[model samples]
Target: MRVRQAKRDQLVAEGVTPYPVTVPTTHSLAQVRADWGHLAAGAESGAEVAVAGRVIFVRNTGKLCFATLQAGDGTQLQVMLSAAVVGADDLGRWKSLVDLGDHVFVRGEVIASRRGELSVMADSWRMASKALRPLPVLHKELSEEQRVRRRYVDLIVRPEARQMVRDRAAVTRAIREVMHARGYLEVETPTLQTVHGGANARPFITHLNAFDLPVTLRIALELHLKRAVVGGIDRVYEIGRIFRNEGIDSSHSPEFTMLEAYEAYGDQESMAELTRELVLAAADALGSRQVAHEQETIDLDAPWSWLPFYDGLSVALGENVSTSTGSDRLRELGKEHGLDLDDDFGPQKMAMELFEALVEPGLIQPTFVCDYPAIAQPLARPHRSSPGLIEAWDLIIGGTERATAFSELIDPQIQRQRLVEQSAAAAAGDEEAMAIDEDFLQALEQGAPPMGGLGLGIDRVMMLLTGAGIRETILFPFVRPQV
Candidate 1:
């Protein structure tokens, strides 16, 4: 650090700007390579162009110097500074002042070196930006802790890190394209709300000073987006951040991106088709519908399988199970299957725990587990045929719940009753229960069309596409403070 600072001081003393306000550039490193890379060895294009990038590699011989410049997208171009072209004095200054991490601007004729490496033969160069600290050792792997703490450095040093950002954007754009193509209106919803009655997740609470009322960072976009449907926007969707006061793990983050779309006059089956299309579209954006994850290849183009929640549980348990199964019997079955069932767990909760442990892991292919217990999803309509089940499905891929859809419950009276039950649970010390939101209820009362809503975890989708963990999908995921 001191050595770099001394070099910066030396440049200032030499009447050179170490941190110039601006520099002219005619092409990105990518464009330069795309246009001039085909030149034969020892051939010069005579196309003088300006380019700027961070210096990643440098070597100086007495009369000639070579420095590799890397652009933000990880494109590299070699800059050859010959004493004849740049003059001996400037060439010498470049060797002395340029560092691996410093940004430099160069004006040069595009050419291929004697060894056939495409390069820029410099006529002039200047410092664009100086770095006070050295970069990490090149080609050395960074520890997970260091990578997460210094993501800027990670993005610079790791090609995969830069690609992850591009892939995420591609996935998001693909989702929006699918939504817009289906005539869904993309919209934004309030991040802070008086009541967070959407998903079954605890919210991060905060105080609103002006209104002098407690508020929470929204845990889901389901409620407000549904309100839009009630307001006559037949189809609406939101790709936004959701905050949950929850535990962190390989697949869970306290804050993450979610895509919630509600289509009026659509049933759970309609949303399932949309969910399939979205997944395939995202996979297509990443250049393949087949993804490699955890030693398995997931074929998004293959026909997806469907299983009722109880039937899946029954298969996993090697016995028939349904809503009629008693809590005590379910607990016995759970214990036999190696689950430590909580005493307070009801029949539905116990069945779910057993299913998650035994069934979810083997659902490597795209499978829609349908007809969950009615209490499991308060916002879903009752199953047309099954008395105790809801018209909902959880899309499980790569052994994780990637998305969920519901035949939305629009009957105001039934919706209120469900929220009332959820409110009681919240009051009874269930932190992950939804609270009653009067405004949402009023919107339902104003008459909403029969709708099907789906919420997809953007991060989890990235994880599947990139074979990365939840934190790696996020640019700057939350990390614990250093002690």
Candidate 2:
């Protein structure tokens, strides 16, 4: 570290800046390789090319020096600086200024060495940015905590870490492509709202200095998108951030990315195909249809199916579970499976909890768990065939819920009644209860079309394809303050 600092000081002594704002280059290393890399061994294209990258490796062979320059996308090429070619005077000063981590521009002709390795024989070089500290020599099997703390360093040292970023971008692009092709209008929604009622989760509260009114970070994107639907933007969607003041787990983050879309004149059942298309699109973007998770391989290429909620629970537990199932009965069955429930949980909440515990874990394949109890889905339209049930689907893969789809209830009276029930639950000590947003109800009174909507967890989708935990997929997950 001290030696690198001395080199930086030496640049100032020679009236040169160690860091320049910009270093122009004619081509990237990857571009050069693609356009003219067909040259055979012991061949020279005789093409003068200019390139810039960070120096990753350096070697001195007396008369000639070889350094490996790496671009941001992990592209690397050998750079040969010879005393005879670049002149001893400039070569000496170049060596003094450049280090392994320093960014530089090299002008050279492409050639092949005796070992048949493609390389750039440089005639000159210039520094773009200088690094003071050295990069670590990384190894496989890094712990989660250590990697999170040193993410920037880990990104350079671990190839998979960098690939995660590229994969994330590709997946996101695929999502937008699928949405746009499906005729959905992409839109942005407010992150800050006076009331957050989209999903049933505790929200992080904050204060607005300008208005002196308390505000909350949005926990879901559904409410506002519905408002747009009321305004006649029939098919609107947004890929945005959602904040939840909840527990952190392998599949849960306090703040995460969501892909939410709404379509007028559609029902919960209508979102099934859209959900499948989006997931398949993401898999296609990654160029694979299979992923490994905890010693099991999930094949996404297989056809997906819908599993009726109560019937599936009945099969999983060897007991019939339905809307009529009492909270005491559900709790009793949950105890049989070694699962505990709090006394405050209602029947609908108890049944869903049991389903998550005894049913979802066994559903490792791509399946939609459909038809929730009406109490479980207040904002969902009631099933035409079964008033006790609502038209909703929870898409589960590899034992984790990946997305949610539902036929939004647009009738103002029913919507108001359900939200009133939710508010009652909130008053009764359920912190994750929905609030009765009168403005949202007023919008509903103005008539919202029968709509189908889906909210996909971007991080969970990445986990399914990358075979990594949610935290591993997120670039910078929340961590405790350093002591």
Estimated TM-score for each candidate: 0.98, 0.96
Per-model tally of clashing residue pairs: 0, 1
> What do the candidate models score in CA lDDT, each in turn?
0.93, 0.88
TM-score, prediction 1: 0.98
Candidate 1 Cα RMSD after full superposition onto the native fold (Å): 1.3
lDDT of 1 by residue, 1-483 (tens): 888899999989989889999998999999999998899999989899999999989999889899899999999999999999999999988988888899999999999999999999999999999999789998789998898999999998899899999999999999999999999999999999999878999899999999999999999999999999999999999999999999998889999999999999998999999999999999989999888867589999999999999988998888999999999998888888888899998888888888889999999999999999987899999998999999999999989999999999999999999999999999999999998889899999999999999999999899988889998999999999998
* Residue range 429-467, candidate 2, lDDT tens digits: 888889899999999999888899899999999999988
In model 2, the worst 10-residue window by lDDT is: 135-144
In candidate 2, residue 226 scores what lDDT? 95
| Model 2 segments more than 4 A misplaced | 139-142
Report how far residue 142 has shifted in candidate 2, in Å.
Answer: 4.5
